[model samples]
Every structure is written in C-alpha cells, then in structure tokens.
Target: MSATQTRTGSCLCEANKFTVKGDPMLFVVCHCMNCKKQTGTAFMSNVMFKEENVDITGCQDVGQYADSNNKSGSTILRHFCNKCGSTMFGKPDETRKTGVVYIPSVLIDGSDAWTPTKEVFAEKKCSFVKELVINSPQ
Candidate 1:
C-alpha cells in the first residue's frame, strides 16, 4: 500500500466507524490479563498509529473508560461502541501528549493483512498459546 493509503472499519453494530491513514507504527499481540478480559480471548492484537492519522465518525455512539487496572499503572482511555460494547481502541494517558493510538486489529478492515511486530506481557501469556514468530521491522 502507498504511504498515504487509508483503511476503514467499524464496531460490531456499525454504530461507530473509523478511518485510519498510512501504515501502522506497530502491530502487537498483548497477553496482559486486562487485554484477555477485555477481548474475551487469551490475547489481543493491536495496531498502533499516530493519533493524527485516525478519524472517527459517530462519536456520540462511542464510550470511554479510564482503565487503570493494567500493568502500566497509568490510565488508558479505552474507547468502545456504546451501542454494542465493541472495543475500538485505546489512548493511553501519554498518548494525549505523544499522539499515539492503539486500535484492536480485529476492528480494522482487511485485518488479515496485519502482522505482529512484537508481543507484550509475555509472562502473562496463556500456557496453551504458542509463541508468535514474526520478522522484526527493525
């Protein structure tokens, strides 16, 4: 895809939609307990991008929670579709100043194209979940 390429996706109910531009900064698989609980899975995949590259429509249908129960110890603004309770993305407290946003890869259109560059909280990874091997973007 071109550097200016754009991707679009929406919540399960289509109550909230988003368009993101350019390639993602990082693609990560998180194994934190908070992530597992939030996604109802053993792990969660996230795609990171510069905050300015994303645009959301139907803001009124989105809900946010100040998540402070994670290992980070910082509050993360977790955005979800209020209508369907579909998790959308997370904006960490630092993101407000650094301008970075992480969205659930499952919520991205054509998500099959996503490749994980790294994994976080591996110590918390479930025993049955195999390790992910991916080429380093370095």
Candidate 2:
C-alpha cells in the first residue's frame, strides 16, 4: 500500500475531524452563486485532495447535505458540523473518479499553505471583495 500523506483539519465545534494526505491537484476560490450561498460569503477557498488519501475520523457526528449543482451537471456534497453548522467541505461529483475531496480553509490548521491559485465564476463575485493576483476562470 502507498503511504498516506497527512494533513489535519477539524470543524467549528471540533466535533468533526479529518486527515488528508497526498498533494492537492487543484486549489481554487469559487465565487459562483452556489458557493456564495453555501458559505454565506463572497467566495469559498478549497483544496482538492485525492479521496483515497483522506482518512476522516469523527465524521460520524457530522452532517452531510446535497446542495446545488456544478457546471458539469453533478451534485455537490456538502459536509458540515450539525452542532456548529460550520461549512466544512464540498465534493464535486465530476471528480469522484479521481477521488477528489474539497477541504475548506477554516478546517485547516495552517491554511496559509493552501492559497488559491485561481478563482472561478468571477463574473458573479461580490463587488466589495477585491481579488489578489489569482487568475479567474472565464
């Protein structure tokens, strides 16, 4: 078996915990309407890891909801903590074959390492929010 790379994360209430391994294939900031509604913010920062490299413990206490759809016509799976209602992660159905896992920055201990390389749906970004040098998907 391949050795798993480990990165620790937790939910707002600390009720849910997880460890993600392997290099993230894509790191992005989503500014789509669905992302704004789900996060209640201008955008969502996400780091995609291979599902096989993720080991989630304490997830039994977590709540999952299927909300919205992606451009690929796939359902988005959102996982959060029931107690605190913290938005944890979003799973895009299109990347299921690659074991893709989207991890929210809030859960990460050292989130500075996961800076977004690009932004999606910038056309709908909040007017008050200024983006950095990250490229936006047209």
Give the poorly placed runs of model 1, Cα more than 4 Å off: 94-96
Kindly list the per-residue Cα lDDT of model 1 for residues 1-138, writing each as its tens digit.
666999998889887889888878999999999888888899989989998889875456887888998787888888888889889988877644568888998788877776899999999999999969754897
RMSD of each: 1.6, 3.9
Worst 10 residues of 2 by lDDT: 1-10
Q: Estimate each model's TM-score.
A: 0.93, 0.83
Error of 1 at 55 (Å): 0.4
Q: List, in order, the clash count of every candidate structure.
A: 0, 2
- lDDT, each prediction: 0.85, 0.74
lDDT of 1 at 57: 58
